[model samples]
Target: MLRHLAVRTRFFDDYLLHAAADGGCHQVVVPAAGLDTRAFRLNWPPNVACYEIDAPEMMAFRERVLAGQAAEPAVARRVPLAADLRGEWTKALLGAGFDPAERSAWLVEGPLIHLEAAESTRLLGEIGDLAAPGSRLALAHGLDPGEAAGPDSEPGSGPGSEPDGDPAGAPRPPGSAPEEDPAAWLTHHGWRATRHDRAAAATSYGRPPGYLTPRLSYLTAERRPPAVAPAVQGRS
Candidate 1:
């Protein structure tokens, strides 16, 4: 099971990184980054800056691990922003030299499930506001079959505690409303989203369908500003 998840995660990360580079983004943001090694492992161009946003404790832990291994990032600049995502993290990101006017890549990988739906939406809105035109977003929002039917069958109950899922003992936020299809959600909010199922992605990676169990919904969207109308020529 762990192997399956690792494969799926690798595939997702590779795809997002390539997509971002292809779209000419110079900055990349990974929210709630916990033990993520992409900054050090991926083959990034010297101009790309990767920011890992997480709590102070998490950053400290990651630093310790890297120090022990003497691991250095491959990217030109790797910034670690120690701030709570539920609070004023965006301020810290900006203070750390994030430029809202420049195109960037945003990755919301494993942490969205831990936030309430409204909080997740707000986070998305914040990203949208910070993103310049042609920026890219990659998200992994997996839905359970039970989530589609209706509200949770029991009060105060939530998704099962998968042992391999999320950080151990990480605080689970309050339960949220059922999630809308991410593609439609992104489309409604000024993005052109393309959704991909895990099976198809696994096959593309030359892996069997069984490689991506408990299928996660993966989507990549590009910010599309509304087009301006052409001026009338009759007066001229």
Candidate 2:
């Protein structure tokens, strides 16, 4: 678990930490939390809140570990919420007293592929709606057969026998990736953004040998602030 997670940690999630720093956000929410340790590892500001929302079992396990290690989170507010992402979680979260006005920087890593476009849209819209103006979101996006070929591209796994499939055949998809253009969809849905495409990620993240193929893309976007002033008729 540690070995597998370590690879994921450095590759994409590290970019989330970078965005939070560069964007100067005060709150962060990690959905489908898994075993992420950003709350303890990252140097969050005093007023910041880091929230982790995941399944009941995972939350319980995390709590048990933290308790065993007597880990007091280094983050200002370490909130561990046990709830399903695909459920009516807003009510549960809000009842737990999450403020909608709080601006947040978010990391939605390792979860989008497992979800539907509609489901991802609902989740993004909810977060976007709650986000205070000018807040940020960073996500790892799998491509949709663009200039950067997708998981179905049939590339070899960087000179290795396919550990999980026939070595001579196509590269495997990272569990149920959506064919839809999720990053573009999010942009149209109100996020003001830019993307780190496959080539860029390969250069930075998988440099030496380079990635087997950068089937993933990374993004960061800020919520559009409200109009500074409404347009007046007959201004000319």
Candidate 3:
């Protein structure tokens, strides 16, 4: 399980860097940011702005910890917006100077599983709405051990109890089934997605396949441009 988490962390770290450097996405947004310190640790390009959104308590906790450590962000701009993901957090994000017209990179990790299926769909839809053409996204998707154990299972008894497990012991929400085809879901939302399975990721990272379980995977996607209607020729 520890190895699994290490691989997942490294994967997303690389994804964010590539999105900013190679993909030309200067604006980055991390929903359910929690205690993540990418804004401080990553080497962002010039004029890059990174937004971290989470609940009020989590935001306050992160601020206090960073303050104590005197941590300075590597990015040119780091904005921490305290807003609940299950609510209208987009307003707070825009008010914090997020420009939806510009291409952006989004990281969605460790949040969706805790939300109901409908809530998860709504969250992704909202993200699609904000993402402009050429925007990049990386997300963690799949069933955790707790989910596999069935909905009625206790939280701490499963793999979710580990340090890298479910955040804050939040059980996988009821009626939240894993998306069978995450790539298809992205395509439906006008994004080109590529899914990396656990085995492939482990091999890429030089980790043994036994280290990671097949139940979890990651998806990296880019928002496609809107389709234009064809012009009709007028009868002469």
State the weakest 10-residue window (summed lDDT) of model 1.
Answer: 156-165
**1 versus 3: better lDDT goes to:** 3
Question: Every model's Cα RMSD, please?
Answer: 9.2, 8.7, 8.7
Model 3 — TM-score against the truth?
Answer: 0.83
| lDDT (tens digit, per residue) of candidate 2 on 1-236 | 45333444665555556556666666778888898888887666566678899999999999999899888787777789998889877776677656778667778877777778668767777777777776777676655334355455543222111122223322233232223544445555556655554434445555543443445445566777765677788956
Top-lDDT structure, candidate number: 3
User: Which is better, 1 or 2, measured by TM-score?
Assistant: 1
User: Model 1 residue 68 lDDT?
Assistant: 99
Judged by lDDT against the true structure, how good is candidate 2?
Answer: 0.64
lDDT by residue (12-46, candidate 3, tens digit) is: 99889989988889999999998899899877778
RMSD of 1: 9.2
The full ranking of all candidates by TM-score, starting with the best, is: 3, 1, 2
Clashing pairs in 2: none
